[model samples]
Target: MSRRSSRRSPAITSTSPCPCGLGETLGETLGECCGPLHAGSTTAATAERLMRSRYSAFAVADEAYLLRTWHPSTRPARVELDPAVRWTRLEVLGSTGGGALHAEGTVEFRAHLTDAGRADVLHERSRFTRVDGQWVYLDAL
Candidate 1:
């Protein structure tokens, strides 16, 4: 197992609401509703799922998982999570492709966040690619 897996944080509980606003209780604390993805399972089955998991990663400050799932072509050497920012909600506006047979996909979303008591929203259309049978975040479009 990798160091990331070994150091999995125990902050999230099984009954906690997913930070991505998936409306599902985290059955296991693996990724707080995206456990399978963060646990090194196969790529998310859909673009929306990948998007949600990524949002949850930001919410929980899982920089390792974010980097692991990012496409190598565009992935940065390091990811820095802002402790002062608190992610509040996620709204998946739409998605295209990103299925069992597709190699590429796009997900549009708006994430609500608060930083230093100031509320804000982040909107973007993200691209994704399947690499070696796993979904990886490419970039924002």
Candidate 2:
């Protein structure tokens, strides 16, 4: 098994609300949503799905999934998420040209987190593109 597969994902249940905050909005649990994406059993069909799964990866500290979904041209050697910062919520503000028919797209979002009891938001408009017909994150705008 590869290092990514060997690494255990954070334990979550089928009924548990997804960290990406899609559970309440879309009625998708962790198991029914980002879990398969992170497990490599499925790939994101749209840029927004990729974006949301990346946020869920951050929330669960799954660096493997993050790196896997990143475009190789810009993918880092490794990802190190701050353990002190808890990703709490995701607010996808908007998106453009990220449909199933588009080759490139952008997603604007606000990720809310709390570090040492202090809350903060990281707002960014991120870019995505298809490589070999798979959606991958490119960069932030």
Candidate 3:
């Protein structure tokens, strides 16, 4: 096995601070933040929140959550998460629309990660849409 697949990592704890950098000051835990979204117990009210939750899912390697929250129009048959990629941080740069009253929205962010011992960042402005009143990822701009 490759180095990344040789080790098993626990994703999150109820008390662990959120990986998406949310509550950076108040210190929000994953259980109190994205955990609910990941569990299907709740849905994001805004596009930005969905964006954060998506980042958190990547950090935790919750491929199911990622695929579930992806818009069907753009979703792939499967999402193959690389164990070698360790998502580290998220920075929400800006947003447009994607509110409760809007059907579409866009969020810009910088997702930092370490891949195979190399540090890199994925920066993009992502689009979101409401399908059946639930927020789902559409694509990147």
Query: Among these predicted structures, which one has the highest TM-score?
Result: 3
TM-score of each: 0.83, 0.89, 0.90
What would the TM-score be for candidate 2 when compared with the true structure?
Answer: 0.89
- lDDT order, best first, reads 2, 3, 1
Over the stretch 1-141, how does candidate 2's per-residue lDDT look in tens digits? 244433434554556789888767889898788889988999999999999999988877778888899999999898877667778889999999989999999999999989988999999999999999999999999
Q: Which pairs of residues collide in candidate 1?
A: none
Candidate closer to the true structure by TM-score (higher is better), 1 or 2: 2
Residue pairs in steric clash, candidate 3? none
* Residues 6-69, model 1: lDDT tens digits: 3423455435567777745434443445766766665577777888888877776778889888
C-alpha lDDT score of every prediction, in listed order? 0.77, 0.86, 0.85
Let me know the TM-score candidate 3 reaches against the reference structure.
0.90
Q: List ranges where model 3 is wrong by over 4 Å.
A: 1-11
lDDT of 1 at 78: 82
Model 3 C-alpha lDDT per residue in residues 5-42, reported as the tens digit of each score = 22224755657788878845557788888889988999
Ranking by TM-score: 3, 2, 1
**Candidate 3: residue 89 Cα off by (Å):** 0.8
